[model samples]
Target: MAAQVLALLRALSGPEAPLEELRALHSALQAVPLGELRERADDLRLGPLFALLGPGSRREQTTLCVSILERLLQAVEPVDVARNFRVDLQKGLAHPSDSVKTLTLSQVGRIVESSDAVTEILNNAELLKQIVYCIGGENLSVAKAAIKSLSRVSLTQTGLEALFESDLLDDLKNVMKTNDIVRYRVYELIVEISSTSPESLNYCTTSGLITELLRELTGEDVLVRATCIEMVTSLAQSHHGRQYLAQEGVIDQISNIIVGAESDPFSSFYLPGFVKFFGNLAVMDSPQQICERYPVFVEKVFEMTESQDPTMVGVAVDTIGILGSTVEGKQVLHKAGTHFEHLLMKVGYQVKNASTELKIRCLDAISSLLYLSPEQETDDLLRMTESWFSSLSRDSLELLRGISNQPFPELRCAALKVFTAMANQPWAQKLMFNSPGFVEYVMDRSVERDKTSKDAKYELVKALANSKTIAEIFGNPNYLRLRAYLSEGPYYVKPVSVTAVEGAE
Candidate 1:
């Protein structure tokens, strides 16, 4: 079956083959045996079949050819098959036909994903250099595919080292500066490269690529801005990258974005990423120095807490949280009480309907604010809670009920976290326990014995820990058994049990 399928595929891929025959050939090849397919991959006719199929006008045929090449690569040894068709494949990289180049690049990506093939290719430095050169070629599509292939290959440290030593970075920068269409691709490549060998950024920085990327962040293209923001954020994550970003005036640009009050949606989306970037920077650098140098930026972030857009509020909340988590941030928020109160109010409002991600962020912000603010600000905190606590509690209870009935453990865990946080608040606790049958309802659901229900029980343990009221409510022998199961079941289960025990005490 495989021999016949390969023969048909080879014949259909020839120039003289009718399109109908090729379509039929593709249909027949789908059921071929793996071993037989491997044997056919070495057939001399396979090269022309792949080359012809690579550039076919029909998208289906082209996709099938690419799939065939990928399957063949998996089935056959790369060393045995690659040498025979290397020249033909390289030619497809520059083929005037788009279909051919696309399929060929797809094949290259697959080969790059294979560790042994990548190692073999890298050992042939000349061939590797040629491939790198193709990454910056004039054809945007081809260049993008080549860049993606390189990124996949560079997953290994040796391959990453090769990329750092090669001229790929220089070429990418040159394209970034000169080419608008490919700028996004260049930005992606920068991120991929940085992720693999963030230290390689030093080489780029020495060559002034960091400055170029910073400039690109201000580009009019939203995609370019977004990509540059992501890349900068990734770069700023590392100690060396943070130093480079700070030196490149990235913080100033980021500060301007937050304080500039730019109402552009694109800018708004990029702002949180930038804030996150700065958070990483703060983690790496001295937050005290950063705060002192950019006090106004911090102020503006606090001011943005009152923004109508939940997104802005979320970012501001997060930025403040990052700041407040540090001594410098705590000091700044302490001096900015009215600002913190307004921010907390916005966060409370956001918790009502914010996306899950933003809600998680708001939760983190609340935790941070609770930690940093003076005890005297309890009134402000309580006021913030009053505004949205009822709605959030209602929503959280519904989620808890839903998770209790669901089989997934993670959702139940998430519900428990929301409950525990609410259970921590005095007013929320009073409301929850006072609600009609709410206490017994939760306790009943908590005792269900499904594997997925462990999360519910674990959360019950936490809720019981948060308040003396809960400890008294569930202090029975049954609840105690649940607590022991949570503590001793597995290493992973013990933390929740400990929290419950501490809360109960």
Candidate 2:
């Protein structure tokens, strides 16, 4: 049915062709399920319709052509769309008809948005030059369409790399220098890049994009500001972006948003992105930079950990890990007693159902806190928690053990590294041997047999093997055997029952 209808439509291309047949074919094409059209698209017949989108085509032919391309782009491989219509699509964008230009640009954006594979074609330097040229075209609708296409193209890796590689940003800056209306389209491109591509995000930070984004952040649009915050979060993904953000007083700007969140609920809504932005900034760059730049950031992050809102809590947990992962950050966390208290508070917070990102954050925060904690607090935490071998209450020891058993190797290793660091400390070693099945949890990492487990178990056993740490539990033969199994060598000792101890006494 499609082939027959398409055939009639193609036959109507002549000047003498019937208008009735043109209307019928246009309606027929729209009525066909996109899937059916895709499955039955005869290139031999449809190719000419695609060609009709170029200059000199009649208005009815061009509109129908755009409609067909729209459907095909949705259902077919975007790479195929680029291949079949690349020449015509480019021509349509350059056509005398603004409608043709607009429709072609919209469809091109659709292709770029949907197919990760078609970026290579869209990235063609010459093709991109044409698209960029159209971005400043006199027709307002045409230029907006070009901007929308550029935004979509900026969403993927190849398209983004091309945009970053090309002179597009320079051109965009020049265009926006005098053109206020075009700047909104530029804002769309920036926000789209900030939201979607980390590579693009990093590039935007240095290529005058951070300056533009910061400038536009003064605008009244909530989305632009929200997306600007989002761009900061993306900048957090790379070292360059973070340093640029910090050096340029973006933190001060961000704090204004965070501080302003107190009054405006709508403004407050964007706090998660701010949370992530600050969190990422905390880790990749200097701790001194984060601390010196944002003096109250640690306290802000701590308050968030205890929030009733789970998203705030999750981002806060991640922020804490990054903030405390460094020596300076850890020292800052340790000096402020409440930071560790709040961090330990999250240990048992929905441990079983937490997302992997949250779980990793939990492991990291606990590990860093353990590393920075004073000897007395560390011992108290271990002893009191070890005393709860049979209790329902949450404590740091159980948190460590639970994190060790989690499915993520990175989480397990992070937990174990802290334990290994503390194994030489009496407090940590005592809990390892006496906290009920803790030794087995350390050695029997058959739960996950990956290389990290083997390596972690080796380091842990070597730490626990110290005779000084094992002496207290040697009176229990079960402890002796478990220690022997883990520690190896002359440390191998047999179990003695209670009766034997009684006999000795």
Candidate 3:
């Protein structure tokens, strides 16, 4: 039965093969019992079944072959099949027929997924070259399948190194430069390949692919730009790629994308990705160079805090936060104190009007910036927070209160963190501590809702720890009752109790 199926597939693969003949072949293969087909899947002649998938040829026969291969792959042990016909299968990857190449590559990926030995067979340098060659082939499906197979086979550092040593990187660059549709497909392959072996950075840089891709950042097509962003992101995963980006001045191009407006409908959708790319680049490049080369870029980002689009505003805030946390970034913000104040005012307003996530991001960025700013900037920071706190609406206050109760430790940490910074100041601390027993009020709330107020209680404890006057006030006999209740609070509360007891003694 397997012999008959193979002969029929061969006959149907020919140009002279009639439609009726192909139909007959399909029926015959489909009629083969599952057990027999599974047995034949283990045979070497299974390699020829791939040739039947011609573009204009027997659709019915092709579908049946696909179904049979899917079954056979599931049922047969790939190691047995790989050992029996590994060379024939590798040759099928480069067959003149697109159908053959596609099916062969798909089966290869499946075989590799099923058994590590199959990958060992495909990992041969010569065989790997054939697979990489198919990536530049005219057949889209075949090229894509080849890429998928390469991703699986190149799991090892040695395999990945061999792939980069091959002409695969050059082939991918050619496809990306020449064909728009294929460009998208192949760029993903490039990302996959580069991600697995960052040592491939040498190949990318030597082949000048990095410069080509950097130019794509400003392409008119959003998808092209998006794919470029993904590739660059993956490439930037390595020290070499990061150093190349800095040496090549790629950040300037990325900054242009961020500051420049697009008239296309989908351009706005890509803006967030652009912003994220810049954020990653900021992390990768030296902060001193970023501040020196892109001073205007920094200013524009500060201005983008006012963007009505929440995504744009959120990304901008994140970028600013990243910058502000860096040393040179701190220097930039410190030098531009007036500009920083204006940006903070806009961010505070956005925190009031933005969505909960956006507001949280805005608050985090502002808090991070203030946390990193110098002591001389403390007065300026406090003045801004005071003005914003005074004007906060009921809705804004409710958001802050809800944020104070967030489940994620980090969000609550950020919220209380800003409050700590604000409350440590002379005027702000006096205002908050003297707000008709505000410290007592917070302590009472912390005790009553100990479960939800871990962060709040923690912050209150630290606030007291840092202030002698606050500690003395809490030590008074009237407040001692509240302090005793806090002693019996949650585990996080006990440490503070121990501290207070130590101080009192």
Please, what is the whole-model Cα lDDT of each candidate in the order they appear? 0.60, 0.63, 0.61
TM-scores, all candidates, are 0.66, 0.50, 0.56
Tens-place lDDT per residue, model 3, 424-463, is 4455455654555556545654433444456456555555
| Clash pairs detected, candidate 3 | none
Give residue 370's error in model 3 in angstroms. Answer: 3.1
lDDT of 1 by residue, 1-505 (tens): 7767666655653654565766665666677767777666556256655645534345665665565555565566655444566776666665655556666666666567766566765665544555555655677777778778777766776776666666655555565555565665666666666655555665445555566778878766666676688778776666666666667667787777666546675666566676666665665676777767777566657666767777777777777667756555555555665555555556656655666666667766654543312333355555544443333344544544554445445444544555555555556556566656656655454445556455545565555553444445444563565455456542243234433455664
Candidate 2: pairs in clash: none
Choose the strongest candidate by lDDT. 2
- Counted clashes in each candidate structure: 2, 0, 0
Ranking the candidates on lDDT from highest down gives 2, 3, 1
Q: Highest TM-score: which candidate?
A: 1
Deviation in Å, model 1, residue 100 alpha carbon: 4.7
The residue-level lDDT of candidate 2 at 299 comes to 61
Cα deviation of 324, candidate 2, in Å: 1.6
Ranking by TM-score: 1, 3, 2
Q: What is the Cα-based TM-score of model 3?
A: 0.56
